[model samples]
Target chain A: EDKVVQSPLSLVVHEGDTVTLNCSYEVTNFRSLLWYKQEKKAPTFLFMLTSSGIEKKSGRLSSILDKKELFSILNITATQTGDSAIYLCAAPNNNAGNMLTFGGGTRLMVKP
Target chain B: SQTIHQWPATLVQPVGSPLSLECTVEGTSNPNLYWYRQAAGRGLQLLFYSVGIGQISSEVPQNLSASRPQDRQFILSSKKLLLSDSGFYLCAWSKGWGIQETQYFGPGTRLLVL
Candidate 1:
């Protein structure tokens, strides 16, 4: 069975703190890993990591993939209340028409 | 630029009642469309996907059914609603057939069943 697991299901931190969210997966054929941020109703695309050892960054957010360990991590630096949301990690299920298999997600709360 | 739209931002339905949710995309053609449901504080569960017109692929078997009537339009319908069916429904579109593409999601429709 292919599944993705996230660590620290919920976290609360003060503004300006740095947080690392983890995601590990076990799948038959791994193609790519994606990260999304869900604020209220919709989830916006954050980053997509295909090759290991390559880091993808946008502003204060960064992510890396470790295929050997079957895991990925998302780091948010200089956190603000605007960054509070549910972070989701997902990967393509190679056996199932490339359908994405998503992790349970990590709820992040940045307090001022 | 591509955008997806979902109707009836919020809906309150009763158990055993019918359901009809619509999603349409603009500025793109022959794009891959997907429908997903998210429970409160939970991850997304893919319900259906369409590669092209008149093509519907279901990821899970449930009370819900989907249809792609046009190139950029996808619909999710249920003969009868269930309490468990209430959730946030989202529609997404990707550029091509490959899974390596990035998916853009709509604002989403919140369904509450009593």
Candidate 2:
């Protein structure tokens, strides 16, 4: 079975703090990794990582994937309360359903 | 721009009641549709997926079932709801049916089975 694990299931930090969320995966085959931010509703797309080493960034958020290491990391810099949410990491699997196996998710709370 | 919609936004029902949640995609046709459930503090679990009309594939075996009666409309149903059925139900769509395709999500429906 394909599995995705995330570290520090929950985090509480003050504004301006930097946090690094981790996600590791175990799949029979590798395709791509994805990041999503969920607030009180549906999750929105963040970044998709297909290659190792190179980083994908959007404003205060950035993520990197390591195929050999079988893991990925999402970094939030100068975090604000608006950045507070459950950060989810997922990997697309080679299943007939075109499914994504997701991590339990790292819940980050930014206190102002 | 493509969009997906799922309704009713919130539903509360007694246990053993029947369930029927509807999802539809607009601005696109023949897109791959998927149904997922997110329990409190858990990751999204794939319940069903449809590659085209009348082609539904279930990922998990449970009290839930799905149908895609139209190219853009998908439905999740259950003959009898269980308390375990309470969760956030999400619908998604993708242009292609591939592991690499990016799926866009709907606002989601919150189902509460008491």
Top-DockQ structure, candidate number: 2
Each candidate: RMSD to true structure? 1.4, 1.3
Query: What TM-score, computed on C-alpha atoms, does each candidate reach?
Result: 0.96, 0.96
lDDT of 1 by residue, B1-114 (tens): 778999989999999999999999999888888899999988899999888899889989999999999999999999999999999999988875354467889999999999
Q: Name model 2 segments beyond 4 Å from true.
A: B97-100
Question: The CA-based lDDT of model 1 is what?
Answer: 0.90
- Candidate 2, residues B72-94, lDDT tens digits: the string is 99999999999999999999887
Each model's C-alpha lDDT? 0.90, 0.91
Task: Summing lDDT over every window of 10 consecutive residues in candidate 1 chain A, give the lowest-scoring window.
Answer: A92-101
lDDT of 2 by residue, A3-109 (tens): 99998899999999999999999988787888999999988999988899999999989999999999999999999999999999888778666777889999999
- For model 1 the local lDDT of residue B14 reads 92
Clashing pairs in 1: none
Interface C-alpha RMSD, model 2: 1.6
